[model samples]
Target: MTNTHAAAADGAEPPQGPPAPNHESGTGGAGGKTNPAEGRVPTTHPHPKTHRTPDGLDAHLVVNRTTFRLDIKLTAAPGDVVALLGPNGAGKTTALRALAGLVPLTAGHLRLDGAELDRTPPESRPVGVVFQDYLLFPHLTALDNIAFGPRCQGATKAASRAQAAEWLARMGLTEHATAKPRHLSGGQSQRVALARALATSPRLLLLDEPLAALDARTRLEVRAQLRRHLAEFEAVAVLVTHDPLDAMVLADRLVVIEDGRAVQEGTPSDIARHPRTDYIAQLVGLNLYKGHADGHTVRLDIGPAITTTEILSGPAFVAFPPSAVTLFRDPPTGSSARNHWRCEVAGLETHGDQIRADLTGELPLAADLTTVAAAELDLHPGAPVWATVKATQTHAYPA
Candidate 1:
């Protein structure tokens, strides 16, 4: 495979972690300086002062391709792990590349710790990356692989190896120091890749699908380890992944991107509880609807009105989980469920132990049922059914 790792410039200092940037000084003030800019790059439009955090990352990245454009504003305090989440072709990778300087910005600025990095070369920027594949040099031992960054930044061979050894020990991989990439297990290789990335002590760390390459069992163990490592990192970290579990577990905040734009951003629970877009709704496994709210009832723009526990007037959103929907072969009268929709089974698939039925009709939604329940109803594509949800099961929030 191709080598994609890059190193910081010579004589750069490892970040000392953050107390928080001092806004008045335009650098890490009382908070120890993480990565100080070598020199300022002149810019016609400086990053907005309101968004500048001298101990973190503040960027409005805009990359224009012939057929697609990615425009997203990302901001994170030092010690923050932010995830860019979306489906395929949703520009998550494009945003990561922009942060790494692999792709030039068509518009907007890239600033880290209040210094402009819009024009910095990839190799010169104080950033590190952990690619999906780890990209360890196939010919190098684990120790050499972790030492590569420090060596490139002008560390003496002995000093570089020593630093790499320290990282390997920290990652609990000292025993595997002499092992090559091909000799290490998936989790060990991932830890080696992470140690390599952190070995340079980058101010901004970008991970593109860090857990994508691991098997299920290995991913479980490695994900926990990665989370701990990320938590201990003192610099800003941006993670790109489509897996909701990874984003929810590893990131301090989430920016949900779709069609080259951010559709929603918030804490994992906040985004899961109140999704602003269908993509987010589906990612979090909730059925979301946009409508105008009057009191406790929201009349959807297209589907049937839903009654929610929240009393609000104006544009709002209603969401419920697939488990909240109870399907019936026939519409029942005198039911406690405040909302019911006649739907046709569009498709059926196994979602864990339950069968997830994709239904379409008055309201498009997903419903989960036990195998026994599905068999009892003889559920299949094109089968008509009634789906009911209690008002208490639906959550409503402002649009």
Candidate 2:
């Protein structure tokens, strides 16, 4: 099932929450202590002109077919990396195709390096794309595949191969230059694909699920390598993926798509801290509350008092990660944190070394604890538990 809904092509800020970036490796955990990029999110407000296009690549896209449609707006700076993140049917791929001119635009404008390209053909658009499968020709050697693009652009054959050799060496594929695509491992093939794309000298690069085909063990190593390559490339790069960890790790900003619309967009840390949709909430594992802020507290529907450092005076959001919530089989005393509720454990899920308990109480919330902690509490789906969270840890900000 493909999602053809319209999403925000224009980048914007996502809701705020506990610092998402500062979390550890893997998607997320209940009580992981370290974040790869600690404090990756900025706590300040955006400037009045914060939306200005970067490196002069401004794109507005609306693409439609009989069975699917996509609309989005985006602008990128010379070295900025933007990620389009969504579930399978979220229209991320359709949006990318629209920008590359692989699919015709029903409406909207695209400008790269100050030149309008909405009407340009794919070959003329100065854009490079790395497909999900690392679609190199099986018969062609890695060197030849890289040289293919340059040669097609009118460089002499020898010159093209020389340039190809240079790129292969740059990618640490020097020893594998003569190996055909069939002999290349997943990571090697990916590098060859990337090198080939870059050899075309695109001003904007589009990568679609660049690591989806690799085995689990390879994703981590390749991702780290990809991050370095993206950082070194002096141009805007937009990648599409569903993995929140990947977006947070590989990109400077994220555009979250749900059913075709960009429900939220921001830095990985921003989205992680404050997820706006139920989809995002589940993806990041947090209890998200939205309401008005006046004086010392934010009022919820079936409200509880939340104390916070932020004192915004109007509509706002309050959020906290599951690990911040403490659970007990029985109500416990001697705690300073103000918020608590008694609830039945609706469900229990085990992931890696931790257990996630979904609680149905006055306020429905999820709690993360170590397997040992869960065992210590003798937790089960039907068990009763008291849940608690500190007001100070519950982040609050203007909605």
Q: Name the top TM-score candidate.
A: 1
* Residue 279, candidate 2: alpha-carbon lDDT: 81
How far residue 219's Cα lies from its native spot in candidate 1, in Å, is 0.4
Off by over 4 Å in 2: 1-55, 65-68, 302-309
Tens digits of per-residue lDDT, candidate 1, 1-399, equal 001222223332222232111111112223212111111111111111223245699999999999999999999997789999999999998898788776889999999988899997565667776777766767778887766655555555677688788778878999999998899998898888787667666678888898998899999999999898787777788899999999999999999999999998999988988899988888889999999999999999998899999999999999999999999989878899999999999999999999999999999999999999999999999999999999999999999
RMSD per prediction, one decimal?
9.1, 13.4
Task: Mark the 10 consecutive residues where model 2 has the least summed lDDT.
Answer: 33-42
Query: Model 2: per-residue lDDT, tens digit, 95-128?
Result: 8777666577888888887888887655455667
What's each prediction's clash count?
Answer: 0, 14
In candidate 1, the residue pairs with backbone N, CA or C atoms under 3 Å apart (3 or more residues apart, or in different chains) clash, namely: none
